[model samples]
Target chain A: MLVCRDLVKSYRNKTAVSGISLDVEPGKIYALLGPNGSGKTTWMKIVAGLVKPTSGTITYNGEPIGANTKRKIAYMPTEPFFYDYMTIANVGKYYQDFFDDFDPNRFEELIKQMDLNMTDKAKSLSSGLAAKLKIAATLARKAELYLLDEPLNGVDIIARDHVITAILEAANENSSIVLSSHLVDELEKIIDNAVFIKDGSMVLCGEAEKIRAERGKSIVDLYKEIYA
Target chain B: MFKLMKYEFRKQLLSKIVILAMVGILELMFIYGVIAEKANTVASAVGFFMVLAFISIMFVSFECAFTYSKDLKTKQSYMLFLTPNSAYGIVGAKVLTTIAQVFLTGVVFGTVIIANILFMAAKYHSVKEVIEVVQQFFKEAMQLDIQMDLIVSLLVYMLVYWILLIVIAMFAITLTYTFLANAKFKELVSIALFFLILWGVQKIAEFILPDLAHITSYIMLGATGIYLVLTALFYLGTAWMLDKKVSV
Candidate 1:
């Protein structure tokens, strides 16, 4: 479970996130819906302890975001952030060394299932394969909360299913998955909660079924209704 | 902490290997020249190694700082900050790794030089004369009394001074990255901060110790103490900034 209050992040002349607050509970998959630069990644980075918020407070189960919570919160940034010299196997080894909950065997399985070679250099991987590598490496961790920023982006249509499956496999009764993507239709059926954000502020947030029934529209429809 | 250091070392493996390979080649050249009894080859090898040693020291001294700056500017930093390690641990590991690398390099160079001296002495059959010549050279060139104890103290003092250099560079670079992260003149600011800190340290040493010119064991020990304290302070300051302000 996680809590964020009045979270705001500002750069020189622009604020990436402004006065956005949300709570996340366990056992659910959250879709952080927004267009590009809507502060989804910034919010996730704040929660992941990668970025310091200008004015806000974020906590995981009553503790502030830090090394302790970092052990339990696994974040997958959209960009390919692996060392240039790392092979797929080396990436797995790095994760294993850093995170105690990281399962090397599971990482190997995910790498194979994603149709990736162990010895292939991460820098040489195509964009799609790189996305799969990020997803595989992230899901391999048995973290309590997984914040995946644009996990489905750059993934091919055929491999999209594998990535989604891997994500679902990582979720359990004790775990929560928060993912951000523009492909609302792809995430519509899987995500249990839908949070719409626009212009660095929360526009709508609620349970997927409740919102659909109350508004008489699917998550994809609502996405278009809110943004367009 | 050791795990972090392990990765830190791994990150620097390629550069270390390059330095080691060059040193190895030079050492082999020296040995070959000695066995072959060619004075010209011996002189060339020794001359090249002295230059190599200077370059190697500069590289080993500042490689981690450069790595830190690169890490901050690039997404590669996520590889480090995403881990469950604290800033203190991360910075501490880097500092410790640099220290270890410098010490290892010193040992390698020291061993080679000592062996080369002994080998030359054996070849010429003048061990006593070689020692006398070294003592005489030091006494005349440095204008200071030459003794074995003084030499050991000076070597230890140099090691401490080297560490001070590394910590000061790290602090300056961290300050630049944290404060002027988006500034256009980032490198200029970093260089300025480095010199400012270095000057501040020098002034403090001057204030604390009056007679810096005269060579004495007490002054050397006192300077060593001052450098060690300054190194620790800079290290802590860098770590604190990293923990409180740095973002990547």
Candidate 2:
């Protein structure tokens, strides 16, 4: 349940997100499809309250995004964003310290499921393992909305399935999940809706199956048509 | 705010072990210097002051540079900024933690120095005479008027100065790093731009407020307050920029 109106983000003279508007409904997985520099990450960051819009307003469930709204949203960045010296246990403790809804037991369970050691420092993990750890840590929160940026990027094919499964398990009937990734085919089986963005604007957005049925094209075909 | 502060304290605690160990080594050196003073007072005093100067410089530089740079290099800032806490809370926690660490280290070092001086003095003089001698030495070494009120005020001023310097430096470093991280010519451009900005700010401050040297301590304190306010403004600016401008 997030709404963004006339959201525009620019750096100096270059416009990264040019006046895009969108609404996310609860209990649905929305796959944000965009090529590199399409402003998908910008939009997600704005919605997560991590970045302020240059000229726009974002409301979470009606009110403006603030501390209360932020408490309900969990954002996982695409980069490896943790202290080098932080072990999995310390990272868990960090989450526990910051977010009241963070479930330490769930975090440990996720770590075990991912076959990651709690004592291993985050920096020492491989990129795939790091991505898995990031995903697991993010999903351990009892947040109402989850914004994951390129969670599957650089991960092995086998690990991709694990990440997707973790996302599915983390998504509850009352919660909404927005994920951005280039792996469209993998997302096709799980995502309920697709929002296609190109050149900092939304080109296509609707129910995934309905768009295919109405347009006689899959999400991948639609992606090519919009960007190419 | 308390939660944020507690986390900040913990982070600093884990990272400052190396610094604490260095302080420990310096303490041992101070003890050795005092113990060997009878053989060579001038040499011992010179060695002690040299070590003191080295420790102070290293501590200040390390605290200023690495505290913020490590966060950027490690990308730990994402976790920090994305928390539900306010930017003020985050920056304030960092400033407070640095101040706390420095203050605690100063206390420890001061106690060690005092104990060493007292032990050396007791070897040659009566206990009362030793106490007087130690007091006199402190009064002269610190160059203060030796009043309780003056000492308390000086301590407070020093604490504030430490906080303001660390906070301003951190805000500047974090902001510069964030802007530079996504730039085309990252390392060189960032360093050049940072120095340019610093130069520009200094020039502006000088131009706006001339005759700064002639200002009284009270006026200097006021100016320090203004600097702190500016530091807070920079913290907010950095936070806004990161939230809105950052892509990665």
Candidate 3:
């Protein structure tokens, strides 16, 4: 499980995550629900150790996140992150070199399922293809925690399903996945833990099914109710 | 660190090919002109390559600076920071790659220099005039004889300086992105800071060693040592900044 307490990240005059504490457990799909600039990405980045929290503590399994914890965390950024010179095959090689938990065979299989080729250069791939590749690469790792930032943003309807399926497939009894996205409808059916964040603070959070039954509304309806 | 350097080297692979190809072409042109006894062609080739060499050196230094800064400016950084590599390893690998590129470049140009010297010696049947001018220039500048020890120390000093330039450049870029990250004129501030630091280092060196006219092996070795230490410090500072300040 990943735990963050009193997490706050600020940039200049703006506060991204304002004293927010969150706990995530294994074997469940988490939807970090938020609108654009609602501090979801910043929170995820802090947990991923890509961004340093201005004032707070984030621990993975009772240890502070650092180079060691990075091995267990797979973070997929919203934008294209591979070098321009990298081919899809090279991307796999990079992961193979860096992450000991990386499964090359799984990566090849996932790429095939996503309709991505090994020979395709990362820079030349279309946005949808790139997004698929990111998911494929992230899922290739047998990570304890996966932080995916806005994986469904700007994706098409069909590709959105592929992404959701990839997320589901990436999960296991020993692994937890934290997926941040504003597109709640696509994620509502798959996510078990729903965390609604608004204006850099968590507004609502609970078990998806229990909350739905108690509130008498779907997660998406709750998203609209909370944020809209 | 080795894996990191492998990717860094691969990133520079294309530029290396293009630049080396140009160098080969220029060298061939120069040799052909010499065989044909075409003075104009030989002179033009030398002039062109001189400019190319300067540009290439500048490119390598800039690439060294931008390699880390680009990670901050572009999303490409996620690919790196996401790895389990420490900031020290990431920055160390880059510095090593820069050194390798610079070393290879020196060897290539050194070969050309040797080949040209041999060519001119064979063509003229003597290097008497060239030797005389070189010796005269050294004597006048240093007010001392140019011994083998002096030559070796000078080479070491220059090599140390080359690495220092790259490390300091990376340090400056890291400082800009981390400290003045949100500043509207960060780039401009970075440039100014680079020059200011360069001048400060130079002034300090000049202050410490004011008697360059009485050059000796010990003096040259001391200067090289200073440069080496500075390179290490700058590299460590750059890595520390990346770890502590830069978010991406």
Candidate scoring better on lDDT of 1 and 2: 1
Error of 3 at B235 (Å): 2.3
Residue-wise lDDT of candidate 3 within B1-248, one digit each (tens)? 99998888887788889889999999999998988999999999999988988888778756867677777777888888989988899988888888788778867887897788678778877787766766787789889655898889888888788788877778888889888888877667777888887877777677777755366888888778878888889889988988877887
Candidate 2 pairs with clashing backbones:
A51-B243
Model 2, runs deviating above 4 Å? B13-15, B30-66, B69-74, B121-126, B136-151, B170-248
Candidate 1 accuracy as lDDT: 0.90
- Residue A152 Cα positional deviation in candidate 3, in Å, after optimal superposition: 2.3
The TM-scores, one per candidate, come to 0.94, 0.82, 0.91
Q: Where does candidate 3 clash, by residue pair? A: none
Clashing pairs in 1: none
Candidate 1 all-Cα RMSD:
2.2
The residue-level lDDT of candidate 2 at B48 comes to 61
The CA lDDT of each predicted structure is 0.90, 0.75, 0.86
Docking class of 1: high
Candidate 2 lDDT = 0.75
Docking class of 3: medium
Sort order, lDDT high to low:
1, 3, 2
Better of 1 and 3 by TM-score: 1
DockQ-best of 1 and 2: 1
Q: At residue A103, what lDDT does model 3 achieve? A: 99
Model 1 Cα lDDT, one tens digit per residue, B26-98:
8899889989988898899999999988888789878988888887788989999999988888888998898
